[model samples]
Target: MEYIHGRTGDQILGSTSIPAERKGVYQYMATAIQKLLRIPIPPELPPPPPPSALNNDVFRLVMFLDTEAPRIYQNADQLELHLNTIFITAHDICFTELLYLHMGSIYEQLKGLSNEPMVFCYGDIHPGNFIINDDGHITIIDFSETSILPSSFARYAIVSTSKLSRG
Candidate 1:
């Protein structure tokens, strides 16, 4: 909850709000803002490459997460921890039905792309949940359900089928 307040796109992007003459001041101020708010600096990163194949995108995302996990986790098993958790032991009927409908649609679309080369991905990929720096670097967050499933449509399927589901 606390982390969210500091890393929102608005917060980082808003660094530009500082006067141009005070770029150096803004840099330190940004760090101070994060510190004052108790927000940890995100992992240092190299610039992101130009958009490439979907497989590469997903792989890049996973690599980013994998890199961060150790700093965020004290041990290997702890990597599986969830920051916010809720389970539908007795799933709501409407929610279940809606999810089923969506899943079916997603399945059909994935099947069509199964023959292509692609990267594996956990189903969700929203920008708000993910973070990108001005360097063009991006990181994956909310790994409650991430994996490397087999696929042919570019490691992870591009914004075609899964992308629509994201919207």
Candidate 2:
């Protein structure tokens, strides 16, 4: 990983939040993502990585319990749980509808854009994942989740798919 010399978007948006300044930062992020979204489709693209584990209820329930209440795991608590979403079902009789929506919406939206022209994606496009250069340009970072997907599917991969901003 190369050292990127610049202030992160989060740093730029410190404590005093201003309307115009935040808007500019968001615009920069959109512009940078847009640039990646316009890359020419590759000739023979590799299959995308496995969908997020959040797509599976058993997996997600285990994850949720692990996050929301680790005591359940520490004590070896055996609890049956399910997750259901308007977009997808993580299990037969799902219960965690709200959480499922984040992962499922991405899956359904991506499935719908399968045939569209592909584009390059940094895959993680949140403010914390980008740097604001001295020249007012935004630099996207964290290529660990980088991917190439249909242009229409790029947005689903960039933002709103992760557990960020949701508590």
Please report, as a residue range, the 10-residue window in candidate 1 with the lowest summed lDDT.
78-87
TM-score of 1: 0.27
**Local distance difference test scores for all models:** 0.33, 0.48
What's the TM-score of each model vs. the native?
Answer: 0.27, 0.55
Best by TM-score: 2
Pairs in clash, predicted candidate 2: none
C-alpha-based local distance difference test score of model 1: 0.33
**Which residues of candidate 2, in runs, are more than 4 Å off?**
45-114, 158-167
Model 2: what TM-score? 0.55
Residue-by-residue lDDT tens digits, candidate 2, 1-167: 68788888778777348989877777888898888777665454345522222212111221233323222211101221212232244432222333233336333311223344545645555678779888886778766555443343354444343445442
User: Model 1, 109-142: lDDT tens per residue?
Assistant: 1122223222234434433344555453444455
lDDT of 2 at 52: 22
